[model samples]
Target: MTPDAILALYEWVIGACFRCGDANLFVTPIDAVVTPRGERYPLAACGGCVLDMEEERRRFAERKGEKYHPGRLGRPPA
Candidate 1:
């Protein structure tokens, strides 16, 4: 992907921290997928945000009276 697109996604993830109400958190890159096309990207998450996400998910699930599952993260195969 282009640098601009990658940066926008990075900024998006950062902004999501606020949406999750875990704005104090940030991601730490641990690994990244290499698309079959050969583009690489980072896979990371902030502990605080993760916790917040989990809590939100829990609330949503309870509100709906069932567990919620967020699908895997990554781009489609090339």
Candidate 2:
């Protein structure tokens, strides 16, 4: 199976966001991130959390004087 499909399956098993612990039928499956201790963990986010994350990134970009190009950050509408 493809990586995305695998991630989707993993999300299906968990059924909630690692960060916010919000459960949903569909969540954005994030790629695994490595921590300072060398542990890897995959994450998922509900729609609301995803939008909030994007907004935070945009604000950070503005503060850094970098252009925040909003493109394809979230799931496409059904």
Best by lDDT: 2
TM-scores for the candidates: 0.36, 0.57
Please provide, for model 2 over 1-78, each residue's C-alpha lDDT reduced to its tens digit, 9 standing for 90 to 100. 333433343333435776688775567675567899999887777655656666776798899998764423434522
Off by more than 4 A, model 2: 1-14, 33-40, 71-78
Model 1 local distance difference test score: 0.47
What lDDT score is found at residue 39 in candidate 1?
98
Any runs in candidate 1 off by more than 4 Å, and if so which? 1-40, 67-78
The 10-residue segment with the lowest total lDDT in model 1: 69-78
| Residue 70 miss distance in model 1 (angstroms) | 11
TM-score of 1: 0.36
Residue 62 CA displacement from its true place in model 2, Å:
0.3
Our model 2 lands, by Cα RMSD against the true structure, at 9.2
Cα lDDT listed for each candidate: 0.47, 0.59
- As a TM-score, model 2 comes out at 0.57
Scored against the true structure, residue 17 in model 2 reaches a CA lDDT of: 75
Candidate 2 residue 73 C-alpha distance from true site, Å: 6.3
Winning model by TM-score: 2
